[model samples]
Target: MLQSVPDDGLLPVDTAQFRTAMGRFASGITIVTARVDDIDHAMTASAFTSVSLTPPLVLVCVEKIARFHDAILRAGKWGVSVLGASAVDVSTHLARRGRPLLGQLDSYPHYRGRTGAALLSDALAWLECRTWATYDGGDHTIVVGEVVALDVARSSEPALLYHEGSYRTVQETTDER
Candidate 1:
């Protein structure tokens, strides 16, 4: 049976506690990309999920102050590149604050998707989406998109994962617990 919080629960959640608790759920890493004019921008994000099937919707949470937040709003379209284990370096770079504004992706190989958003050529999977909706999410803004194009680039590779504030990779095991 499900239990509810105490009736006296009037206090706000502790920030550190809330963050640590949320971090326990492992999630695959992704690079959110957008293009404005001729420049490409990308940010590392893990707060992405599929929201619907009938309309093929997906949601990505971008912090209000994130560099990509405003740009994404203006671009109207975005791309999600699900990173493989080999792309941890790329993830780290994009996740850093104050990262280079120009030539950020100079070292990596990529191509433009149908929406004109840059897609990492070696990603495990890719999704190109058009913004469908937006909603308030406290310090973050929830952007919903309708999937316009998607594909799996490398299905056999292990996905890059994040848990407890660290990067990890999945491994297949023959022994079942």
Candidate 2:
């Protein structure tokens, strides 16, 4: 039987507990990038998912306070590079707060997509998208995009996963079916 709780003008759980609970769900990591005014901005985001296949849509959530948030809004276009397990350093560097804005992508091999957004060269997959819509999501903005271009790597690589607040890699196993 399902039980219902009455509304009491209070959150069901505190932020820390909510975060811990959500952390238990494993998610793939990606580097979301945008270029505005000829300068590039990027953020490590796991809050991404495909929305539709018929339209080839995807969404990424960016904290309202992050600089990348504003840049993505202004650029109106962005790229997502689904990271492989070997790109932890790339993810960590991009996730750092207050990191230098200039020459940030210098260490990583990447190329500008058709939309002028940066895409990591060795990512498992690349997606270039144009902003389709935006919605308010409390502390974060939910940005949806219609994919304009995409590519997949020729070879398979272990996917980078985030769970329990740490980076993880998929373990290969024999097919049982």
Candidate 3:
């Protein structure tokens, strides 16, 4: 049964309930990075997806109040590092709020993308994108981008995933149909 809502049409569930419900959907994690004025800003995001294949489009949702949001808009470019299971520490560090502005990536092994965004050396894959559009998404902004460059690393590593409010990794099986 669905809960009744007021005339405002908003769902009756609170933010915590909504978040808890959404957490059931497992998703791969990625570190979205952008550079502005020689400083790198990054956020551990699971709200990322590929939108198109013809033009190679992808999008990442950023909280409106996050510093990376403004930095990405200003820079007009960004990088997405598809995290592997080994990069759990990298994700944890970047996911922390109120992290220092400078020297944030100093502890991690990274390299500069062609767009000057930082790409994690331990990533399973890398993507460099140019901002193509931005749309309002309640308290977040949906920033779509045209993938300019991308590569998949040559390694046999499981991908990091997020589900049920915790980090997880996938297991491979040999059940071939």
For model 1, the local distance difference test gives 0.93
Q: Give residue 97's lDDT in candidate 1 (0 to 100).
A: 94
- Which digits, one per residue and each the tens of the lDDT, describe model 2 over residues 55-151? 9999999999998999999999999999999999999999999999998999999999999999999999999999999999878999999999999
TM-score of each: 0.92, 0.92, 0.92
Model 1 per-residue lDDT tens digits across residues 51-119:
999999999999999888998999999999999999999999999999987888888899999999999
- The CA lDDT of each predicted structure is 0.93, 0.95, 0.94
| Collision pairs in model 1 | none
Question: How far out, in Å, is residue 177 in model 2?
Answer: 8.0
Q: When superposed on Cα atoms, how far off is each prediction in RMSD?
A: 4.5, 4.5, 3.9
lDDT of 3 by residue, 1-177 (tens): 354566986756799989999999999999999998888999999999999998999999999999889999999999999999988898999999998989999999999999999999999999999999999887899999999999999989999999998899999789888
After superposition, the stretches of candidate 3 with alpha carbons farther than 4 Å from their true spots are 1-11, 174-177
Query: What are the runs in model 2 whose C-alpha is more than 4 Å off?
Result: 1-11, 175-177
Candidate 1 global TM-score = 0.92
For candidate 3, the 10 contiguous residues with the lowest summed lDDT are 1-10
Q: Which is the leading candidate under TM-score?
A: 2
Highest lDDT: give the candidate number: 2
Cα deviation at 158, candidate 1, in Å, is: 0.5
